[model samples]
Target: MRLTPDEGDLTARAFARLDARLTRDTGRPVALALSGGGDSIALLRLATEWARARGRSVLALTVDHGLNPESGGWTAFAAEAARAAGADWCGLSWDGDKPQTGLTAAARAARHGLIAQAAREAGARVVLFAQTADDIAEADLMRSEGSTLGRVREWSPSPAWPQGRGLMLLRPLLGERRAVLRDWLAGQGADWIEDPANVDPKFGRSRARQALAGAAPPAPEEARALAGGRPTMDGEAMVNVRRDIGARALAAALVCVGGGATPPRGARLQALTARLRAGENFAATLCGARIEAAGDAVRVMREAGDLGRRGTAPQVLTPGVEAVWDGRFTFRAEHPGWSVEAARGRLASLSDADRTEINRLPAATRGAWPVLIRDGALAPVLAGEGVERRALVAERLRLALDETTHEDDLISATR
Candidate 1:
């Protein structure tokens, strides 16, 4: 059924609300992702009229995920609706083969990709999504139910583009409820596509949506806070500054030992560790070697894994420094606790698979190992035939304990 011109009135109002929410300034185009669903169709209809009033036009994009067999038919319906609404409509399709993880995440990623592409093609700065308050509330529920705080903050600014990606994602109707959108659409005599999968229990979001259908609607302020709508500065600037400062400072603090193979320990490492914890000049990499910041000292070990275990070592560091085991212990420059020659020999003794495993790690993790570079050559501790690998491990553990205690002291000092 064709929507009459009279239906354009309600849509226009909805569009105005969306516009006011997304764009406070004028003379800019707004791109709408029209899904041929009740919410998006209503959005597109109103957006067109709203744009007309501002001497602009609506750029509508319909993404065909191809998940449903009837998606082609739906696409045609969406295009026609766009035409009726007087929007410059475009269609996008996805062509990726199915993955083992099923189609939901893939389809969402594809849909956003298409929307971004269409928005870019139209030269539109802001791409509007019809997500509503219910969506936010449901996500809130999901977060509250989960134990991991990591999952709650994963909705980062979209990385779809290098510069304008932030503009590519704006949920204008995010403050509205699904029922409100439906009511507004009904007033326009409009209908929308109802995907059966939306109600399927197997999908976590589907279940969440179903639960949301019965819950009391959220307050506007609560929704706004969850969506990060308070006053803010440039997040990109903050992140870049943090990463650069942290990385460089850490790099500078690292002390090379065992002919530049092993890292520093006791006081030298502790000083570096102090700066790292203070969020000051950090110059170390956690990806390669393990570093522990203790009271006024930092300890470095060449081997540490996710499970918090450090393997055997003579603890070779820089060319001039090495911690050697000989049933009796000593620090030497020429013999260097463990000789640079002995360290090189140990690395050569490793099997091909062990070498591959070590090499596969990132530079940060690999740097943490008890290996050192002597004149640009790989060097590792030979584990001093009779000296127990367990002794070196015990010393590393003690350093870690000291680091923890010092970290607590730093925190207490700050407080």
Candidate 2:
């Protein structure tokens, strides 16, 4: 019986590609979302061998969606399989009420969020996914059927909001077929769970999978669309797209500003994108972001809302603990007894110069800016004494505008 993947085999090579991608400290464990399915089980086994040789560890996380009656059993199997494969295991569950209409999408988002949080807490900067060649074909088919399921790539930043802030996802098995992995598992005498949902007709993925009729996965070619035109961003992350930007680029910019899970719909987004390309002067709202375009320049920012409703929801800071607020900013405080909230009522207390600068921003942004607070006194966005703050929205816009963003979305073949 085979105890490890053959060194020259595709599976081994797939795991080997992780060497250059891991930029974190060598001591930190690499994370995997193990579902006990054929693909993930194969990856966990192969990765176990890969990590051991590199003096690293693997953390396998199994998320129990609780949608199936046998979910508990699946979780148990995943834990056992991970441990048997010489990897650490953790079981996470989806604990809230399920949405009746979009259970699939909601479950996926929740699963990602849970995994991202767990990985971050464990100091894992990269999350390994078992997305195989078959999964890619299936995603394409699902999209053709008008499903909004996102395009899966070999490597990309985690799509889950705030929780996925600092994590990158690596799909090493993207070049391998599901059947190849299953055959390898069989050779290794490994058993895997088959989730019944994979065959359910109600789901788009299931339908897409069944429609394949055993066709081969498409070639490992790049499918991302690269956009043109650089965007100028300011200190506030106000994006000014002067030249031309694609729908995806605009959508990404709005995602940063809106800080919402859902991007703008295709029709409305295409319409607005056309207007921007034509250099029309107009203002509009999509998702939670407000856009103002003038003379070939498009600027986006978070829309002003009823901040008092939640009042920016002050989050107590823990010493050396990093937290994300409103999905736009990441905050870290060196010492405790501090918190972060909105610049609502405290805006009136700003110095004359501070007030003048704040007024320069759109009315949509003035009151909602994040403020560091201590003993009920509001501190400026630039907090003192070991406080570290970063605007996630700005980073997102920068990535969206960078031409190399899409070009570097895949793992290097040679590496």
Candidate 3:
């Protein structure tokens, strides 16, 4: 259904505010994760019009989780809706056997990965999601019932690991209520799917949704606030500690420097944050990141023992295939090499300069750093042997320090 004049104007203003939030990528398309549900259907309608008005285009992506027999029908419906809305569409599928446990969280992660990969390939720096204020309420309720789901925000970097790198999620509808959107869709004569899973009591979200069926969402939590100068990264993937850093920001630094998928949570993370905030001189480890504080300055790096305990070992570098080791370094090879392994036990064989550099890092950090193989001998990575390798410090640090971690105000950056 075409938007009424008021609806069109509302969408333009809402999206225009978001578009101004980030650097525009000039000519790249914006992507929407279209699930054929009420929220996404409304989003598809609004986005197509919003994009067209600004001379931009929209790509609607649907991920077929393959859990329901009706999933195919859902995907097809999504395609048709996108077409009707004047947006291009693509369908992705989760093709493997479903795990018996943790299915919901797993499916969500898979969906995030698929959408993030597709968005990047389409040259989008941001992917639009249709989460509304109801989602925030549900999350709060679920957490109260002991769920582990992270709190949803109006905007965040995508949650999928490396796949979600370089992309941000735009939830322009976060301030909108689910019921209001559904009511508007009905008035427009637009239809959407009501997935059976939503009402299934087996799921925490479903239970929460049922409990609050008609209850107005409580005031949304204040968006996460970030303050102070950003943390610095030394050559060794160390985040130089600073006073007055937020716990969330400090958690982000630990996760990045430690090469972990997510930041540590609960009491330990809070304790660490407290220490740094006081500018105390202490050494501690949380997640895989080890901290060395000297009162005047602090350094955070990967704990090599953590890597070994986690069974990090050598692996062959496959030509043309991107390889990630310790989640800290990524390597691609177009020619022969022995393997990518830790610098421990093999530091003596490296060139003098390479050895010196490696040794300069804190002793606990050097072992987890990557060292390449040349002619079956452990060696520092050579410059011209058809290999490409980089420490992922800059990219990870940038994400951790992204100032908009808590603000959603609907402004978006161009890619």
Candidate 4:
């Protein structure tokens, strides 16, 4: 694990490249998730130095999962390290009833959720993670062993969106090795905490690491070309093009419209794409989305049944706080005391014009549209003449599609 002077020089160059890419993608005021581990500590130092040189700011966030008694001390140490690097620091905790089973998965989700929330509150649009080459190799091994884990890309859209509104996740250190990073830290006379979970054989990741000993690190993946603008596809034209593009684009559309966390299964998606390519006209449902093919066009929308099953009860909207209703639309009110509920059953009360506008949307998705209530009367918030709000929703949907499309394209290219 020892690094020569040349390796150290290469690591520095890699850091510089990452800094430039991050600065170009996300401007001032970046956020870093610091865990008091060697990888994250190295990232904190590198990001702080880069931000200082560019006259920008960095927000260092540490999440205390509270699973271990020593987590509090780890957070304090992380905060101190951030301060030593001349960066602003914040600590968040995952406080709630701990699950009896699947503790690791639950904690990981909580950690990401808390980090995204904190970054949004701090007005940061991008958060950096410290996952390294070693982590990627281990993840690949886990997947080969039928773990069902997904690949971690270098640039990914935040999984916890709306709560993480306008946020992107960056793993700049994915190209660097863990040993090199720790060696770099040692050379700088810096210290980091060693979490016992890393070696607690009960964890699959720990077992993977031990199994990876003496194995050559996997070759670094070439950075994928992300679309600079929003992705658009004509369903009719897509079927005539590459099957990969058609399938990937279709998956992205379904996930975006359905507001699902992950895309549908690969085999099912591919089969659907094949059917569409054969010019079949039919309707079906998958991943909370209703897919309809008519004439030469295919359309996808949120499934009404799924919405009814999972929709949240009416909640009062507070001024300056945004809420995601029905997991499809993000609602924020400038005025207070407004309650948001599904537009279902209340559409009958609207004017003919409003009703027509509501009906223009896909039949399967009309039930999930957000409606405002005040004084016990329903009001059309997103229907008819509310062009600005409609445009905002469209923009968010486009962004989501862009992210999913980018990841899909990357995976296809790599395969």
Per lDDT, the best of the predicted structures is 3
lDDT, candidate 2, 331-363, per-residue tens: 788887778877777787777777887888877
lDDT value, candidate 4, whole model: 0.69
Which residue pairs of candidate 4 clash?
none
Candidate 4 structure quality by residue, lDDT tens digits, 1-415: 5569745675576566556445533444688999999999998988888777766688999999988899999999999999999999999989989999988878877888889888877867678899888888898998888675656767666766446545667787877788888888988899999999999899999999999976767755554543322335432111112222355456656766666666664568878877777777888888777777776556676677776786567877666666666555555667665777777767777677767877877776777666677645555554322111221233344444443333222222111
Candidate 4, residue 350: the lDDT equals 66
The whole-model C-alpha lDDT of candidate 2 against the native structure comes to 0.76
TM-score of each predicted structure versus truth: 0.51, 0.87, 0.87, 0.84
Looking at model 3, which ten-residue stretch has the lowest summed lDDT? 406-415
lDDT tens string, model 1, 169-279? Answer: 445565566776777687657878887877888876777887878686564331111111111111110001121123222332231111121233334445554565575
Write down the lDDT of every candidate, Cα atoms only.
Answer: 0.49, 0.76, 0.77, 0.69
- For residue 376, model 3's alpha carbon misses the true position, in angstroms, by 3.4
Number of the candidate with higher lDDT, 1 or 4: 4
- The list of candidate 2 runs beyond 4 A from truth reads 1-8, 23-25, 220-225, 306-312, 318-320, 333-339, 344-346, 377-387, 397-415
